[model samples]
Target: MGKKGILLVNLGTPDSPEVSDVRRYLDEFLMDERVIDINAFQRTLLVKGIIVPFRSPKTSKLYKEIWDENGSPLLYFSKIQAAMVQEKLGDEYQVELAMRYQNPSIASGLDRLKAGLVESIQVIPLFPQYASASTGSVIQKVMELVGKWQTVPPISFINSFHDNELMIDTFAENAQKYQPESYDQILFSFHGLPERQLKKCDHTGQHCLKKDDCCSTLTDVNKFCYSAQCHDTARLIAKKLNIPAEKYSVCFQSRLGKEPWVQPYTSDVLKALAEKGKKRLLVFCPAFVADCLETLYEVSVEYHEEFRALGGEEVQLVASLNDDPKFIDALVAMVKN
Candidate 1:
């Protein structure tokens, strides 16, 4: 008889918010085929020759904005999360924290667990939704590393917890703190993926965007679709908060060099709302479990500025589930069962 091993993985951060470190981080992150979904040579040219060279300094500055005296918010909170889960789980399990793309790599996390010689291992990729780029990449990387082991322990992975009740409640509870009714509209904005990625996830060839309201509800045809899961997550949170369907919009953000990404883009949605004379806005970024660059800098600063310039009064972000006791409790439940 033996204890279970738990490994938690999140999308990574740069070693530091310096230009060189940011460049290295971006190169590693964007070069993933799952991420950019382009031919290797073209990805290299786009990432190395263009993005890394041009965007590194700009991105470093964004990281700097979110970075604090304690360092990267994502990593900082991730550390607290792992420690808390470990403490609550007691000596029955050993918990390890990892990042999909950077320091405290998945390899190290798995190795540490294997050293613990537990009877089984459970891997929880921190992304709430399942996407080829994020959760899928982590699964593939974990398998690729552990597949080499001579004696592999029985292992399981949590693919997605988008509709996890406790998790959704946590997000809704966070939004309630800001008085959701005070805002003119609520936006549930998720990180964007290229339309091609959505198509690839569509098991039925004709299901994706081929019919009206394709992503309006989740079904077998699009159950694994990232956009659908994102929509489902938003719907659950909104329903929990008693928000009417018309009062909120499900949108996507952080698109880059896009041919097209799952739309309506958050930026475009804000413009539409502004044109309609909707001033105050409340935004929930449920995609990210911890408050990082995307939630803290992009949503809070960049989007707010853009919206205000468009004549919107305010764009307030609902804080993420960062080491919140309730969030950690939800995580502990997922780990246990």
Candidate 2:
């Protein structure tokens, strides 16, 4: 018998805040078919020819703002998480950390595990809610690499842990520090997805955007739906905190292009709340387990500025569950059983 191999993967970050490095990272990330969902030629034309070229310089600046002596927050926290998980799991488990894109590639992580001669490999993508562009891409890429191995071991994947009790509690627990009641409006802002993507997840041709209840309720027909899972996550957290259903709003953020993304965008919601005289706002980005550019820069800085310009007083972002002991305990339990 050999040690169990645990591969922990996060979204990823650029090697540095430099424009060149950011460009490379963007090219690799946006070029993913799952991400753009366009033909290869078209995606290449858009990502390489336009998006990466124009966006990289501006995006690098944002990365620089969040970048510290520890470098990228995502990778830094990911390293800490891997170490903690390894320490907790003990010698019986060989844990490796990788990013779905960029440095510490999945190939290197899997190679180390393969060298360790582990009996089985457990893959846990650090995305609370499942989405095709994220967890699905990681799974697909892992399979594409491992399929070529001559001596492949038993492999397992944690598909989605959005409704995990401890995970939900962790977010609620973090918000407790912020005093949720003090805020005028609470926003559970998740990363946005294209409307077409949600439609693709819909097994039934008519079940997607046609129905309104699907977003609030999780059913087998739309169980794999990303929007539904995000809403369910918010619901669980709100329930745990004894928050009223009408008190907080669920919105999506970080959308690209002009296509209609998941509705009630965070920007629009913030603007509306500002106009409604809801000055103090609290935001929870549960989709992200670790504090990254999205949570730190986008939600904290950008959204705060935007809201203030709209006559809002504050846009306080609740901290993420980075290296939290409770989260690690839940992770270990997932791996063991």
The lDDT values for all models are: 0.93, 0.93
- Summarize candidate 1's per-residue lDDT along 237-298 as a digit string, tens digits: 99999999999999999999849889999999999999999999999999999999999989
Q: After superposition, how far is residue 271 of candidate 2 from its true place, in Å?
A: 1.2
Worst 10 residues of 1 by lDDT: 203-212
TM-scores for all candidates?
0.98, 0.99
lDDT of 1: 0.93
Off by over 4 Å in 1: none
Tens-digit lDDT track for model 2 on 1-337?
8999999999989999999999989999999999899899999999989999899999999999999999999899889989999999999999999999998999999999999999999999999888999999999999999999998899999999999998988899999999998888889999999999999998787788896666888988888899999999999999998889988999999999998999889999998898889999999999998999999999999999999999998999999999899999888988998
Q: TM-score for candidate 1, please give it.
A: 0.98
